[model samples]
Target: MVVTRSETQTGAQTGAVQNSSEGWKQQPPYRTTEGDEGFEKKWTAHCHCGRVRYWLSRDGPLASKFCHCVDCQALHGAPFQWAAIFHKEDLRFESGAEGLAFYHAPDKSTTHRLPCKVSCAYCHAPIMDEGRNMVLMFPGIIKFSDAEHKKLFDPQCHIFYSQRVVDIHDGKPKWSKLDGKSELMKEVEREGSNTILGEPKNENMQD
Candidate 1:
């Protein structure tokens, strides 16, 4: 039930695209908590103002998806949210840890307080969404070329499609909610009465 800081701040546009604290490297390639200080090559994430920097040893996200839920819409200011999930241990902030801010909220259907929204105090850009075991990283933060963006930012499915502010016709599977265990979607969901094939379902930009 957790989401990335950038997603919530922008309006939870699962269709597109946190933290603060300490001990981060002040250099360009930041290092994360243990796991394989053993491994080298990492992916660095930073705030809009270049005030914060973090890195991921994982070459890519463990999972990727587009979210179309009300929470996402209320946060990311976009039609849908594009997210990539990674283990918390894989993310690291090189600097600006002390300048981080957190927005704590109870997750859906749960009463426990969780730091779901994290942002940089200076630039206020989303860093990551922390879950119990993993973090939802935003691909939009990555400074990628058009080719890398296309190849590295592939979403596998759409979650919470029923609350969609707009429709996507990418042919990816759409589920009503967290169907992570049931089955992964193979084709796009085309159930809305007002939906038209091959066109976006009037994307909402207002958060």
Candidate 2:
């Protein structure tokens, strides 16, 4: 989710092309057959401006949730965060590798987040999330056509919702607790600086 200044410019330039590609990738009208057993597949989710991109391919996602944490609300500038959970190996990012950034809010919990915040770094659209298998992606970024949006996501529960400003009276279940761990943090520690993929050094900030 890290969005730096320069990535913004490149993202804007490629947005149109990416959006056009999105039109074709929209999920099917009806849910297609799930991938075969033992089958592996990959899907891509990109920042609106396209500078930051990722691929998700592993065994199907373990679970997905729409988060309504205050951090999520502020990050998204929207009602909640839409995220899918997958094994760490399921996610990968390409492009603007240097522009990938990190932030830790001392006022908030000790959680450090990937770039893309402060103002929508990519789309300037007011929604971003930390990157890690644990961080959620904006469903909007999946580039699924409108038809796909209807089928692929209908978040079953909302997490960290006690912090949500609006009451989620839609009968949707709300979860307000979190286990303290940052997936990216663990990944970086294990991989160290010279990661197979470029890995940014851990920033020394109070979480």
Candidate 3:
């Protein structure tokens, strides 16, 4: 369900191209506020089961990064989590808000709390990490028309690299913990390079 710029050019164009002879109906933008005072480009996204749906106010995320923290790996069941940072206000859920589930980290409680992970209740698909100030939305769920549009959500850096189960050589800055607040890790050219140059080996790698 990719939405390209050309497809969203004009309302009349979108309405005309609504359905194909093959019975495939084009998905329109969740909402378009062209005449609004502070209108921004909107992007639509939904859960795997299509139960929960939402849209982003801006065309691009504020910040995007790969998180390699133990919590992220454990929750996502992946090597690392690619997250797109967005202000809470910019994200609007069009449906299934009540059908969404929350998982409070570390404690693993279901209580609605800030800095918690959100997912589709029925499909159990990871949605976003709701923080106090911002939300870290999973870019994988977002619809991109093309590679260029997808690149808008490309990760700027890697966080919690020290705890990563896998080494990423994308050349993005690797932070030992939080970006800016923690040590910036030196890059290793070799594939299995674990030890950081001139730094003590992290023997306490999380399993």
lDDT on C-alpha atoms for all candidate structures: 0.58, 0.41, 0.66
Residue 4 of model 3, lDDT score? 15
Write down the worst ten-residue block by lDDT for model 3. 2-11
> How well does each candidate superpose onto the true structure, as a TM-score?
0.66, 0.49, 0.73
Candidate 2 error regions (>4 Å): 1-41, 107-133, 145-150, 176-207
Which scores better on lDDT, 1 or 2? 1
Candidate 3 TM-score, true structure as reference: 0.73
Model 2 TM-score, 2 decimals: 0.49
Which ten contiguous residues of candidate 2 have the minimum total lDDT?
24-33
lDDT of each residue in 57-165, candidate 1, tens digit only: 6777877988876666666677777888876666676543456665544433211123356667788887766554566788888766567745666898887665565
Each model's RMSD to truth, in Å? 9.2, 16.4, 14.1
Ranking of candidates on lDDT, top first = 3, 1, 2
**For residue 35, what is the lDDT in candidate 1?**
55
lDDT string, candidate 2, 15-67, tens digits: 22222343312321111224424323456656656666656554334556766
On lDDT, the leading prediction is: 3
- The candidate scoring highest on TM-score is 3
